[model samples]
Target chain A: MIRRRKIAEALFKLLSLSALALAIGTLVLLFGALMVDGLGRLDWQFLTSFPSRRASQAGILPAMVGSTLVMLVTACVGIPIGVAAGIYLEEYARRTWLTELIEVTVTNLAGVPSIIFGLLALGLFVYTLGLGPSILTAGLTLALLILPVVIVTTREAIRAIPVHIREAAFALGATKWQTVSDHVLPYSAAGILTGVILALSRAIGETAPIVTIGALTFIAFLPPAPVTSQPPYVSFEWLMSPFTVVPIQMFAWVSRPGEDFAANAAAAGLLLVGMTLVMNGLAIYVRYRMRKRVSW
Target chain B: MEIRETVSISHSSVMESASHRRARRRREFLIEGALLLAALVSVAATITILFVLVFESVGFFETVPLLDFLTDTLWTPLFDDPHYGILPLLAGTIVTSVVGLVVAIPVGTVSAVYLSEFASARLREIIKPVLEMLGAVPTVVYGYFALLVVTPALQWIWPELPGFNMLGPGVVIGIMILPLVISLSEDAMRAVPMMLREGSYAMGATRLQTAWRVVVPAATSGIVAAYVLGISRAVGETMVVAIAAGQNPNLTWNPMEPAATITAYIVQVALGDLPHGSIGYQSIFAAGLVLAVMTFAFNIVGHLMRKRFREVY
Candidate 1:
C-alpha cells in the first residue's frame, strides 16, 4: 500500500507539471508558427500600401487607419462615461437594492458575448439609427462592448483606495465630489489607465462585431482626410465613411484560397498579436508600478 | 494689529456668500446626476441588448413556428426553401464546447492544483503572468493558429481530418480557456486555508494526497464555477470556430466533422449583404437570442457558484 501510494503521488505531480508545460508549450508553438510564416512578409511597404488583388502588393494601411480612427472614437465615447459610472458606483451610490441590481447587471453585461454586441449594433446603430456601416457605428459598438470592462476595472481601482483616505479628505472639509476628484481619482489613475489599456487592447482585436456591423471586406480607399487645406482645416466626413479594421482584414485574407494570402494573414496576425502583447505588457508594467508605489 | 490682519485674511478666504454656497451645492448635485447617468449606461446597454434580441426574434418567430425552430435538425436560413431549426447550430456548439471542456478541465484543474500546492513562489509568479498572456492573446489569432497550424497538425495524425473540422478549433478553444480555468481554480485552491493542509500533513498525507483529498474537496465549488465560466466562454467563442469550423451547418455530433456554430452562422450571414429585416437577416437575431440566453444562464450559475464558495470560507 505504501509503495503504491508513493507511485501515485509521483504520477500526480508529473501529471500536474505536464499540464503547465503543455500550456506554455502551446503558446511557444503559436508564436513560433507566426514568426516562421509572417516574419519575411512583414515590412514597411506591407504596412504603408493599400491591399491589392495580388497578395504580393496587398497592404494593411487602410485597415490600420480605420482601426486607429475607430479606437479614437471608442476611447472618446467610452472612457469618460465608463469612468464616471465607476465613480458613481464606487464613491457615491448608497447600498440599496437598486444599487445591488445595477451591480449585478453590470457584472452580467461583462460576460455577454462580443457577437451579441455586434447584433445590437447592427439592429440599433445600423438600421434604427440609420448610421450605416460607418466608422462611427463600429466605434460605438466596440465602445459598448468595452464599457462593462472599463466600469469593472475603474470600480476595482477606486475600491482599492482605503476608506481612511476618503475620511481624511472629509475631515479636511472636502465635499464628496471634492474628496473623489482630488483624492480618489488621482490615486487610482494608474490602475484605471491599466484597465483602460487592457480593454482597448481587447477591443483592437475584435473582428466579429465589426463584421456584424457590415464593414466592407475589400476597401482600398481611405476615409476622407480628417485634416485638409480647407478653411475649417478639419473634417467629420471620415466618421460616416465605410471602414475595415485589422482583424477583419486578416479574416478576409485568411478566407482566400491561396498560400500567398495565407502568408498575408500570418503577417497581419503578427502585427495584431504584437500590438496586443505590447499593450498587455504595458498594462502589467503599470500595474506593477502602482502596486509598488501605493501601499495604503 | 498683525493678529487682526491674519484673521481678516483667513475669514475672506474661507467664508463664502449664501449665493456662492448654493451655487457650489447645485454644481455638486449636477455633477452627481451626470455621474449617475453615466453609470446607468451599463444597465441601459443590457436592456438594449435584450430588447434588440427579443424584438428581432419576435419578428422572426412570426414567420417560423417556435416548435420547428426548436425541434428541426436543419438550419438552412439562407436556402431558397429556408429551414430555421437551431438544433444543428446548437449541436455544433455543444460538441465543440464539450471537446474543449474535455481537454481543459483536467489539465486546468491539475495545473491549478500544482500551482497552488506544489510550485515554488518564484515559479508561481512567472507561470501566472505567462498564463495571463495566454488569455490576453486575441481570439482572432487563435482562429488563425487553429485554421493554419492546428488543423494541419491534426490532419497529419488522423490522415483524413477535414481542413475545417471542429476538432481543430475545439482544441484551440480548450487552449484558449485554459488560463481562465487555471487562474480561477488556483485562486480557489489557494483560498483553502493552510490549517487544513497542515492537518492533512500531520495525518501523514503526501502533498499530492493532501491536495487531491483535502484541498480539492474544499475548493470544489470554486473549481465548478471556473468550469461553468469556461463553458460559457467556449459556447460564446466566435472567431476560432468561425474560421476553423466550416460555415455549413452540420447537425452531427462528431468532433472530426466541420460544422457551423450559432456564432459562426451569424458571422456567415453578416459577411453577406442580407437586406435589412429580411427573414434571413432576422434569423441571425433569433440565433443570437438563443446564444445570449445560453451564456446568460451559464454566467448566472457561475456567479452563484462563486458566491457559494465565498460564503463557505
Candidate 2:
C-alpha cells in the first residue's frame, strides 16, 4: 500500500510539473514562432509605407497612423472625464447610496464586454448622431471602453493622496476644486497616467469593437491631420470618413486564406505586441518613479 | 481588481462651520453637489448602455420570432425564409468556452495554488507576475496564434477536421483567460490559513493530500468565481472565434466542426455592409443582447459566490 501511494504521488507530481511547463512552453514557443515568421519582413517600409493589394506589396503605415490617431483621440476624450469622475468619487462624494451605486456600476462596466461598447457607439455616435463610421466614432467607442479603467485607476491615485494634505489646504481656506487641482491632481498625476496608459495599451490591441462599427479593414488613406487642413473641418460632415486601424487591418490579413497574408499579419501582430509592451512598460516605469518620489 | 482607495479629505469640511460661520454648510453642500453631478454622469453612462442594448434588442424581436431565436438550430439570417435560430451561435460559444475552461482551470488553478502556497516566496513572486503577463497579452494576438499556429497543428492530429474547427479557438481562449483563473483562485487559496495545512501535515498527510482535501474545499468559492469569470470571458470573446473558428454558423455540437459563436456572427454581420433596419443588421443587436445578458449572468453569479462565501476561522 505504501509503495503504491509513493508511486502515485511521484506520477502526480510529474504530471503537474509537466502541465506547468506546458503553459510556459506555449508562451515561449509562440514568441519564437512569431519571431521566425516575422523577422525578415520587419523593415522601415513596413513601418512607413502604405498598405497594398498584395501581401508582398502591403505595408502597415496607414494602419499604424490610423491606430495612433484613434488612440490619441481616445486618450484626450477619456482622461479628463474619467479623472474628473474619479476625483469626484474619491475626494468629494460622500459615502452615500448613490456613491455606492456608482462604485458597483463602475465595476460592472469594467466587466461589460468590449464588443457591446462598439454596439452602443454605433447606435449613439454612428447612427443616431450620424457621425458615420470614422475615426471620431471609434475614438468615442474606445473612450467609453476605457472609461471604467481610468475611473478606477484615477480613484486609486486620488485616494492615495493623504488626508493631511487636504486638511492643510482646507485649513488654508482653499476651495474644494482648488484643493483638488492644486494638491491632489499633481500628486496623483503619475499614478493616474499609469492607469490611463495601461488602459490605452489594452485598447490599442483590441480588434473587435472597432470592427463592429465597421472600422474599415482596409484603407490606403493616411489619417487626416488632427485638425483637418481643409475647410469645414469641425463640421459633422467631416466625421463620416473611412478609417482603418492596425488591429482591424491585422485581423483582415490574419483571417485571409493565403499563407502570405498570414505572414504579413504576424509581422503586423509583432508591431501590435511591441506597441502593447511599450505602453505597459511605460506604465510600470511611471508608477515606479511615482512610488519612489512619493516614498521619499 | 477593484481596489478601495481610502481617500479622506480633511475632516475640515465637517469642522469648517465652527471657525468660518458664513453659510459654510452651504459650501459643503456645494462641494458635495459637484461630486454628485459627476457621479450622475457615471450612472448615466451605465444607463445609456443598458438602454441602447435593450431598445435595439426590442427592435430585433419585432422583426424575428422570439421563440425561434431562442430554440431553433439554424442561424442563417439572410435566407428569404431565414432561420434566425440562436442555438448554433450559443453552442459554438459553449463548446469553445467549455474547452477553454477545461484547458485553463486545472493548469491555472494549480499554478495559482503553487504560486501562492507551495512555491518559495521568491519563486512565487516571479511566477505570479509572469503568469499575469499572459493576461496582458491581447486576445487579438491570441487569435493570430490560434489561427496561424493552433489550427494547423490541430489539423495534423484530426485530418478530417477543418482548419478552423472549435478546438483551436477553445484552446486559445483557454490560454487567454488562464491568468484570471489562476490569479483569482490563488487569492482564494492563499486566504486559507497556515494552521489547516500544518494540521493535515501533522496528521501524516502528504502535501498533495493537504492541498486537495484541506485547501481546495476552503477555496472552493473562489475557484468557482474564477471559473465563472473565465466563462464570462470566453462567452464574450470575439476575436478568437472570429479569427480561428470560421464564420460558418452551423448548429453542431461536434468540436471538430468549425462553427460561429454569437460574437463571431455579430462580427461577421457587422463586418459586412448589412444595412441598418435590415434583418441582418438587427440580428447583430439581437445577438449582442444575448451575449450581454449571458455575460451579465456569469458576473452576477460570480459576485454572489464571492459574497456568499464566509471563511471559517
Candidate 3:
C-alpha cells in the first residue's frame, strides 16, 4: 500500500508540473505569434510617420498622439472625481441607508457594459451638449468608463491609512478640510494615484466607446488643439479637431482585406500593448513602494 | 485710560470672531455637500445611461414596432424598414455565452481547485500573479488572435462551417475570462476549512477524490457564482464577436455558422455609414441597453450568491 501510494503521489506531481508548463506555454505562444507577425514591419517611420492613402506608407503617429491627448484628458477628468467620491465615502459618509444604497449602485455601475457608456456619451455629450466626434468627447466617455475602477481603488487606499493620523489632525484643532489635505490625501495619494494610472491604461486600450463617439478611422493630421483662443492662448479649434487612436485604427486594419493589413494591425496592436504594459508596470511599482512605506 | 473702553473692544472683537466662525461653517457645509453629491454621481450616471437608451430605443420602435423588435425572426436593419426581429441576435449572443461558460467553468474551477487545494505555497504565489497577467491583456488583442489563429485552425477540422463564425470568439472569450473564473473560484475554495480536506483524506480518499466529492461540494456556491459572472462577461464581450463572428444575424444553434451577437451589431453600426439620425443609431443604443441589462442581472446574482454562501470557517 505504501509503495502504491508513493507512485500515485509521483504521478500527481508530474501531472501538476505539466499543467503549469502548459499555462506558460500558452503565454509564450501568444507573445511569439504577435512578435512574428509584427516585429519585421515595425520601424522608426512606422512610429513617427503620418497616415497615408496608400496602405504601405501609413503610420501610427496620428493615432499615437491622439491616444496620449485623450488619455491625459481622461485622467484629468476621472482621477479627481473618482478619488473625491472615494474619500467622501470612506471618510465622511455615515453608516446609513443612503450610504449602503450608494455602495450597491457603485458596484452595479462597475458591472455596466462599456458599450452603454458610449451610447450615453453619444446622446448627452455628442448630440445634446454638441461636443461632436472629437478628442474631448471620446476622452470624457473613456473617463466615465474608468470611474468605477478609480473609485474602488481610492476607497481601498483611504481605508489603508491609519486612523491615528486623522485623530492627530483633529486633536491639533485642524478643520476637516485641513485634516484631509494635510493627512488623509497625502497618506493615501500614492495608492490612489496608482489606481488612476492603471485605470487610464485600461482606457487607452479601449475601442468600443471611442469608436461609437466617431473617433475617425483615418485622420490625416494629428489632433488639432482641443480648445482655441486669441493669439497666445489655447484655441477652440483644438477642441473640435477630429482624432484617431491606436485601438480604433487597429480595429479598422484588422477588418480590411489585404494580408499586409493584418501585419500592420498586429504591429499597431503591439504598440498599444507595450504602452499599456508600461503604464501597468509603473502603477504596480508605485503601489509596491507605497505599501512598503506604510507599517500598519 | 486703557481700562475705560474694554467693553467696546471686547464686544466688537467677539462679534467679528462669531462672524468668522459662521463663514467657516458655511464653507464646510458646501464642501461636504459637494462630496455627497459626487457619490450621487453614480446614481446620476446610471440613470442617464438608461434614460438615453430608452429614448433612442423609442426612436427605433417608431420605425419598427416593439413586438417586432422583440419577437421577429430576422435582423436586417440595413434594408428598407428592415424587419426588426431581435431574436436572432439574442440567440447568437446566448449561444456564444453558453459555450463560453460551459468551457470556462469546469476548467477554471478545477484549476482553481488545484491551486488552492493541493499546490505548494511557492506554486500558489507564482500561479496567482500569472493569472493576473492573463487578466490584463486587452480584449481586442484576444479577438484578433482568435480570428487569425483559432478560427483558421477550427475550420481545418470542422469543414461544414463558414469561413468566419461564432465558435472561435466563444471559445476565445472562454479563455479570456478564465482568469476571472479561476481567481474568484480559488478565493471561494480556499475559504473552505483545511479540516474538511484532511477529514476526507483520513478516510483514505485520494486527493482527486477528496477535491471532487468533498471540497468541491463544500465550495459549490462560489464555483457556481464564478460561472454566472463569467457567462455575463462573455455575453457582454464586444470585440471578439464583432471581429471573429461574421457580421450576419441568424438564429442558429451551430457554432460554426455566421451569426451576429447583440454586441457585434452595436459595434458594426458604431463603426460607420449610419445616417446621423436614423434607426441605426437608435438600434445601437437599444442593443447596448440589452447588453447592459444582461450583464447587470448576472452581476446581481453573482454578488448575492457570493454573500450568501461565504464559509466563515
Candidate 4:
C-alpha cells in the first residue's frame, strides 16, 4: 500500500509539473521565436517610413499613429460611462430583478465573441450611421467591447471600500454624491485607473473589429490632424478620416506571399507585443502598490 | 423667553433647509437617472446585437431556404454556384474546439489542482502574475505564432500535415485559454473546504486520492463551468483560425487537414469587397446569428450549471 501510494504521488507530481512547464514553456517559446524573427526588422527607419510595395521598405508608422489615435478616442468614450455605470450598480441600484438582469447582461457581454462586436460595429456605425470605416467607428467598437471589463473592475474596486469609511462620511451629514466623489472615488482611483489602462491595452491590440469595419490596410498618410485649418480649428474631421491599426497591418503582412513580408509582420508583431506587455506591466505594478497601500 | 427662542430657532431652520433639501434631492435623482442610463448601455447593446443579427439574417433566409442552409454539406457561398450549407464550417468549428479542449482540459485541470492544493504561497504569487501576462498577449499575436512557429514545428514531425491545418491553431488556442481555465478551476478548488480533504486523509486516502476523489468531485460544477466557457471561446475564436487554419471549407474528421471555421469564413468575406445588401454580404449576418446563438447557449448552460450545482462551502 505504501509503495503504491508513493508511486501515485510521484506520478501526479510529474503530471502537474509538466502542465505548469507547458504553460510557461509556451510563453518562453513564443517570445523567443518572436525575438529571433522580428529583431532584425526593428529600426528607426521601420518606425518612420510608410508602407511600400516592397516589404523591405515598408514601415508601421501610419498604423502606429492610427492605433494611438483610436485608443485615445476609445478612452474618452469608455472610461467615464463605464465608471459611472459601475458606480451606479454598486452604490445606487437596489437588490432587485432589474439589477440582476443588468448584471447578467454585463457578464454575458464580457463573454461574447469579439468578432460579434465587429459585426455589430459593421452594421451600426459603418453602414447605418455612415461613419464610413473611420477611426471613430473603430474606437467606438473597441469602447463597447471593453465596456464590461471596465465596469466590472470598477465595481470591484468600489466594492472594496471599507463600509466604515462610507459611514463616517454619512455621519458627517454628507450626501451620497459628496461622499462618493470625495472619499470613495479618490480611494479607488488607482484600481480604476489600472483596470481602464488594461482595457485600453486590449483595445490597442485588437484586430477583428477594425478589419470588419473596413479599415485601410495600406494607408501612406496619417488621419487628418485633430487640429487643422478647418472652421472648428479643433477639427472633428480626423474622427471621420479612414484609419488602420497595428494588428490589421500585421495580419495583412502575414498573409502576403513572401518571406520579407512575413519578417515585416514579425517586426510589427514584436512592437505590438511590447506595447501590450508594457501596459499590462504598468497595470500590475499599480495593482501591487494599491494592494500594499490599502490592506482592505 | 426660552420657549419663544426655541420656537424661533426651529422655525427658521425648517424654512432654510426645505429648499436646500429639495435641490439636493433633485440633483440626486438626476444623477441616479443618468447613471442608470449608463448602466443600461450593456442591455441596449445586447438588444442591438440581437436585433441587427435577426433583422439582417431575414434577408439571407429569404434568399436561401433555412432548411437548406442548415442541412447542406458544403459551404461555398463565394463560389459561382453558391451553396449556403453551414455543415463544413460547423464541422470545422467542432473539430478545432474538440482539439482545443482535449489539449486544454487535462493540462488546465491538473495545473489548477497543483496551484490550488500544492503550491507554496510565494510560488502561487509568482505564477499568478506570469499567467496574467500570458493572458494579456493578444489573440492576433497567438495567431501569428500559430502560423509561423507551431505549424512549421508540426509539419516537421508529421510530413503529411498540410501547411494550414486545424491542429496548429487548436493547440495555440488551447494554450491561449489555459490561464482562464486554470484561474476559474483553481478558484473552485480552493473554495472546497479543507475539512473534506482532512476527512479523506483520516480514512487513509493519499493526497493525490484526496484531490482527485474528494476535492475534484466537490468542485465539479465550477470545473464544468470553466470547461464550458473555454469551449465558448474556442467556438468563437477568429484571428487564430483565420491566420493558421486554411480557409478551405471542408467537412472532414481529420484535425491534420485545413478547414475553415465560421469565424474564418466571416473574416474571409469581410476582407473582400462584397457590395452591401447582396446575398453574399447578408450571409455573414446569417453566420453571425448562428455563432451568437451557439455562444449564448453555451454561456447559459455554464451559468445554470454554476448556479445549480455549485457547492456552498
Model number with the top TM-score? 4
The candidate that wins on DockQ is 1
DockQ order of candidates, top first: 1, 4, 3, 2
Cα error, candidate 4, residue A232 (Å): 4.7
Query: How do these models rank on lDDT, best leading?
Result: 1, 4, 2, 3
RMSD of each: 1.9, 6.7, 3.2, 1.4
Per-candidate TM vs. native? 0.97, 0.90, 0.92, 0.98
| Rank order (by TM-score, best first) | 4, 1, 3, 2
**Model 4: per-residue Cα lDDT over B223-278, one tens digit each:** 99999988998999999999999898999979999999999989998889888889
Instruction: Write one digit per residue (lDDT tens) for candidate 2, span A104-176.
Output: 8887888888898888887788898888888889888898888899999998998888899999999998878
Point out the higher-scoring one by TM-score: 1 or 4: 4
Residues B1-313 of candidate 1: C-alpha lDDT, one tens digit per residue: 9999999987886675567778889989999999999988888899999999999999999999999999998998878888889999999999999999999999999899999998999999999889988998888889999999999999999999999899999999999999999999988998989999999999999887899999999999999999999999999999999999999999999999999999999999999999998999999999999999999999999999988888887
Docking class of 4: high
**CAPRI category for model 3:** medium
The residue pairs that clash in candidate 4, if any, are none
iRMSD value for model 1: 0.9
- In candidate 2, the residue pairs with backbone N, CA or C atoms under 3 Å apart (3 or more residues apart, or in different chains) clash, namely none
lDDT of 2 by residue, B1-313 (tens): 1232222334555466566645656776676676566556667777887888888888889977799898998988877878988999999999999889989988887777666656678866666556655777777888989988888888888788787889998998998888888878887888888998999999988877788889998888988988898889888999989988989887888888999999999899888898877778878888888999998899888877766554444
User: What DockQ results for candidate 4?
Assistant: 0.81
- How far does residue B142 in candidate 3 sit from its true spot (Å)? 1.3
What is the lDDT for B64 in model 4? 97
Worst 10 residues of 2 chain A by lDDT: A232-241
